[model samples]
Target: MDLQKPAVEPQQPEGCLVVAIRMPVRIVVLVLVVPVRMVWDGLVVVGRFLGDAVLRPLGRALLWLGRVLLVWPLVGLWRYVVVPVGWVLGRLGWVLVVVPVVFLHRYLLAPAGRALVWLARGVGAGLAWAYARVLTPVGHAVLWLVRYLVVVPACWVYEWILAPVGRALAWGARGVGRLLGLLVSGVGVAVYWITRVLLVLPALALWRWVLVPVGRVLAVVAREVGDALGHAWRIAGHLSRAVGRFLATLFRWIFVEPVRWVYRTVLAPLAHVVRDVVLRPAAEAARAVGRTARQALAAARETVRQTRADVRRALFGEPRERDAVPRREPRPLGARTLDSSTTALTKLTKD
Candidate 1:
């Protein structure tokens, strides 16, 4: 029975076929077919949803990108070729305009400016030449007078007189120095001779015989005298200090206090009264006199000013001005001294 049991074919669901099928085999077929159909349907639904949800939008995006790519070539052509040509043409236009302007500036304006500069330079040179022609001689005369009459004379006095005096003084100083040297040498030699012959020999002999006993007696006497002198010196110092202090105190009491009292009592009042009555009145009177003098001076100045205006009108035929000629007075006999002195100074300077 087990060997006779065999596998059975699976049955189709809706096909028109008459076949004997086993129950287990049928159940197996149903299970396999249901799952395969479910998987296929699910794949078809997913494909359709993917087409609607993703592929449509992606296609539209690709179409839009294609249009943009198609437009870019025209824009690139316009930018690279048309705009560059237009820009070049605009720059050429500007260059053409500027070239004419540059030529005009160089050929026309530059020469005009140079001509104006030359004219100004010629005028300035002419003015400078005239100024030099007018002023140079006067300047030379002034310079000549100053150098010859003033500076050269002063330099001559300093160099000739003072230099000789200084040289004589130096020579006299050298002579005096030589005499001093000789005198010092003679005195030094005399002192050396006296020390060697008289002082050294006599002092040595005296030291050998009598100096020891005399020195002892003299030492005792000198010690006593020194003690007495020291005491006397200290007493004198104290007495002198006391006398100075007493004198200071006496002076303060007698002179300073009395003077201060007298100044405060008698002189101060007199000084105040003099200041208030006499000095103040005198100062006020002096101020009034000064004011009156100032007013008179002002009136005199106005009169003189008017007189000068009349004089200028009469003499120079113009009003007084800064550039007017200075007045010269007639010289008396004594005034010739100036010319004489100038001539002497000029001669001295030349010498």
Candidate 2:
């Protein structure tokens, strides 16, 4: 009496048995998530270092006390007294709008576009120098008086009269086509020698005595019936190439060696075990999520270019910089001893 009953095993997936029983409680919550993400990134770097050391120098001392109490007395009452009273009312509004546009571009728009481009380039250089000196020598003296008066008297009346009345009507139509081709070749050579002397000499003596010995006995009985059908077409082409190499070695040992041994033993090792068990761990988790989204878009474009260079150095205060070489202002020690006594009295009046 056989009684054994156990063997069950294969059941797994309750989310893979709750991820293999919470893999050691996710390695003790990844060892307390790295000291709680380093104390929440050290309290977001001490709240961005107390908003960059106490709200950026108390917002640059309230934008330098609102640009020293409202932008330097309205930029010194618009650069010293409303820019010299709007530059004397814009030079009395450009002497009432640019002296009538410089007296209509000096007397009427530049002498009306230079008298309409010098009367259209002096009427196109006086119609191209009257068509090169008086209309090309009055059109070559009216085409030399219509080629010497009316085409040299109509080519001297078509070469004296009409070219000898068209060469006497083409030499009387080639002498009436060589007198009707010598009267139809003398009545076709007198009806071909009167039908080769009445009919063809008794049909050429009855085809040289009856059909030339039947036709050489039907050409020797069609050359012995074409050499007995070329020896029965070369013994049926060597019995159809030995039954086509015995049906191509019985179709390569019955169907190409069991489809090349089941593509070399089962579909090339199940396509290299589904490309090393599923496409190399999904291409290394899509290249670690595209290198953590290109390092968080290069740390958010280097924290928006250090918060726009700390708000343009806290509202334009540290900018100055430009001094290449421009200081001048120092003349008078009696204008350098009166420019060295006018360069020693112009080098003592050029010696």
Candidate 3:
């Protein structure tokens, strides 16, 4: 007998087995879902196309027609006939009502107002002149009398009596202050001499001997340390500057130069292309629409002007030529005979 094991297949996980079993269903679902989605998308596309191409245009046309047929006539009637007639009637009413009022105001109320203003100005001027000439002099005289009677006497008392007393008191205070200051100065000088002999001399000696030497040693050590620190700082600064220079150069090469090149080469050209291809055409189309609208407005204006002219001609008859000479009507025979007899009678009377 052969000592060989039978071949065994690897087992699949439950989840994978379930997936495998449902793959056919998934396939069917995908097949159905794709065609259903396509049909639904097709319907949406057709609906959008029909709405854009047919429904929107029809709606716009209906709106335009309604405006032309109904709204335009109403607007024209209001603007032309009703407004003109109302304006004429308003002018007539204004002439009847406002003219008399204006005339009355100009002739009556305006003159009265002017007279009252003139009178008020004259009265004010008279009062001001009277106050300046008469009242001002009286006030000045009263002030002068009060100063001589009351203020001048008070000033004399203060100057002669109170001022001398105050000066004497100030002099006495200055003399006392000077004496006190001299005494304080002598005491301070003595104290200062004592302290210098006892404390200040010893402190100065210690400072000169011990502190000065120690400070000098510390100064030397600090100077050496400062020199070493300065050298290290110089080396660090040089290294940092070199690193910064390298980084700046690397950044310029990696980012700035490429960005600048792209901006110059690609982005600029693309912007120019978009402007030429899209923006220019859109601008041209907008200009064309504007031109069409302007032409339509101009045509409408010309039609309205012609219509107005026709209406005016119908209402007021044709206008006579400005430069034409007037012609006399032919005389009747009886009128001619009467005119001749009158001329003969005039001649006979002159003879």
Tens digits of per-residue lDDT for model 2 on 1-351?
112334678965544534444455445444544454445545776799999999999999999999999999889999999999999999998999898899999999899999999999999998999899999999999999999999999999999999999999999999999999999999999999999988898788777887776675555445434533443334334444455577779999899998999989998999899889889888998999999999999999999999999999999868889879976988656655543646868668667
Relative to the true structure, candidate 3 reaches a TM of 0.31
Tens digits of per-residue lDDT for model 3, 1-351: 122344667955545534444545445445444444445545776799999999999999999999999999999999999999999999998999899899999999999999999999999999999999999999999999999999999999999999999999999999999999999999999999999999999999999999998897666556545544444444444554566578779999999999999999999999999999999999999999999999999999999999999999999989988897887988656655543646878668667
Clashing residue pairs in all predictions, respectively, total 0, 0, 0
lDDT of 3 at 308: 99
Residue 27 error, candidate 1, Å: 99
**Model 1 lDDT on a 0 to 1 scale:** 0.77
Residue 280 alpha-carbon offset, candidate 1, angstroms: 2.2
Candidate numbers, best TM-score first, in rank order: 3, 2, 1
Q: Which regions in candidate 2 have their CA more than 4 angstroms from the true location?
A: 1-22, 32-34, 41-53, 64-66, 77-82, 104-109, 112-118, 128-351
The 0-to-1 C-alpha lDDT of every candidate, in the order given, reads 0.77, 0.77, 0.81
* Off by more than 4 A, model 1: 1-218, 300-351
Q: Rank all candidate structures by their lDDT, best first, as comma-separated numbers.
A: 3, 2, 1
- The residue pairs in collision within model 1 are none
Which is the leading candidate under TM-score? 3
In candidate 1, clashing pairs total: 0
